[model samples]
Target: MPNAELPQAKRQKMANKTIGTHNGTFHCDEALATFVLKQTDEYSDADVVRSRDPAVLDTCDIVVDVGAVYDAEKKRFDHHQRGFTDVHYGLEIIAKRLGTALDDPKVQYVWLKLYRDFIEAIDAIDNGISQYDSDVPARYRSRTDLSSRVATLNPRWNEPTGAQILDARFQDASALTGKEFFQALDYYRDSWLPAADLVKDLITSSKQSADPSGRILVFEQFAPWKEHLFEIEADENVPSVEPNQAIYVLYPDEAGGNWRVQAVPVSPSSFESRKSLPEAWRGIRDDELSKLTGIDGCIFVHASGFIGGNKTKEGALSMAKKALEL
Candidate 1:
């Protein structure tokens, strides 16, 4: 066989680019910002130079989190100016670098997803914004967040903080943030985006079926539906009023040959449901559940009524339908 079958390391790209940022203890924002720049074709293999010297920064192709400038035409992205208000400063640059128009639906989805999930926190922390409205004590201390973990790569407060030491640590910080950034990007682009389309199809099909309420959705197959459900409903101008909003979702359970009916939450990230399975059916199971709900092939309704199981898709749909009537 040819040597082509052998596993090999990723080939390094030609070094024809330069990315500049301030030289000092690195933060998650600049570390991630630099990683985002390196992902673009123009800077994919760029050399990263950390410095605050105007002369040194001037020679670089792009500067971020430094230079006290915010000119995109000149490739400067700094947020430290007197009145900079663009929290999406980093995203704008990334989109521009990748030649993606902000108005494109897919671009908009991924941009918002990335910002909401991680980048927003980085921007907040860097800008000295509080995470909570009040100064209440946190329930738990989290040293494992990306920002906190990135900060660990910097030299200890008691340790040496030389330029060489800090720069080397910055490389490590960039790698740390880069790994998480691309993973999230890949997930949002490949998995989350596709789920939206799947949910949209399910939503459209649900209306044409026997159900007149249009509040119960039955998926042909399982997909992450929550995030897309609310958005799709709003896009379709479905009123948030009862019988118009989605109350439950029915889909086949992968583990068993049974089916599941899940209550749609009040919001995507919320635990509160718009309408739970049914108070009477809560925690009931087997034949008793079927007897109470007058639905056959019942398995169980969860204690919280968020979900219930049935032996078949029809049974699950029947459960969702009955819940709607109640």
Candidate 2:
């Protein structure tokens, strides 16, 4: 039969593509890889096939985390091959599948953001890389992370290990990962990115008029500022700002109708600040704090000197400026 003469149903069946991965135990990487691929127009309806047979993989339209091949052109994306250190293979595959250039500024931002927030941990676990250099014990243990949650979907050692059984579990794993990935995508795009722009504007304005020292920023409205503060300071496009230059951030306390002066941390992840409020003021409150700092409307300063509150914005700014001089 001539190829064009084939029936519509048979032609449609042939067009339904297959996504291949190794059969047996599944990990977060391949499950996530499969989920990402299925999101694109090209593979939105693709079937998943789990197998170790090269012949079966060759028959599929694309393969991931199997076949010992990492060629993008060939549609194979296994990281187990010798000397393969690219932990972001999933990002590349997604960019290519979406037909969006990786260098596009928006795409680049989301790429790095998602990688930092979500994808990096998965890659690290799959590659057997430790998060810390030393063997120091963690402060606490957490088993509720996405990777850990995915592992719980696998069949128990004592339970059924049939091919159909495993494939069903793989689907569940893919659904679990895909749901979280999309939620993260929505948050970064809808909320976090807008907050970054607002922070940048406020930082620039503060350097111009609000604080001549460029060491204090007063926010009329609060956005999540810590991560954005660090990111803006490190950005090469913004001029005259060194890392950790901004020492204090002042903002209104919506609930108490007071205002707050907060010390920026040494780094976004650290509990320690670049500079703390004066030692004498720490743990002081009310009239004593007002008398000690000579700033009116004083409420309290934290014991650790990371934060203090005042009844007004002017009082908070005065507190921050006084602390800067000390």
Estimate every model's Cα lDDT from 0 to 1. 0.82, 0.85
CA error at residue 76 for candidate 1, angstroms? 3.0
Give the TM-score of each candidate.
0.84, 0.90
Candidate 2 — what's its lDDT?
0.85
lDDT of 2 by residue, 272-323 (tens): 9999999999999999999999989999999999999999999998999989
Alpha carbon deviation, residue 176, candidate 2 (Å): 0.7
Error of 2 at 164 (Å): 1.1
RMSD of each: 7.0, 2.7
Give the poorly placed runs of model 2, Cα more than 4 Å off: 3-7, 87-103, 136-140
Best by lDDT: 2
Give the Cα error of residue 46 in candidate 2, in Å. Answer: 1.9
Give the distance in Å from residue 172's predicted Cα in candidate 1 to where it truly belongs: 1.7
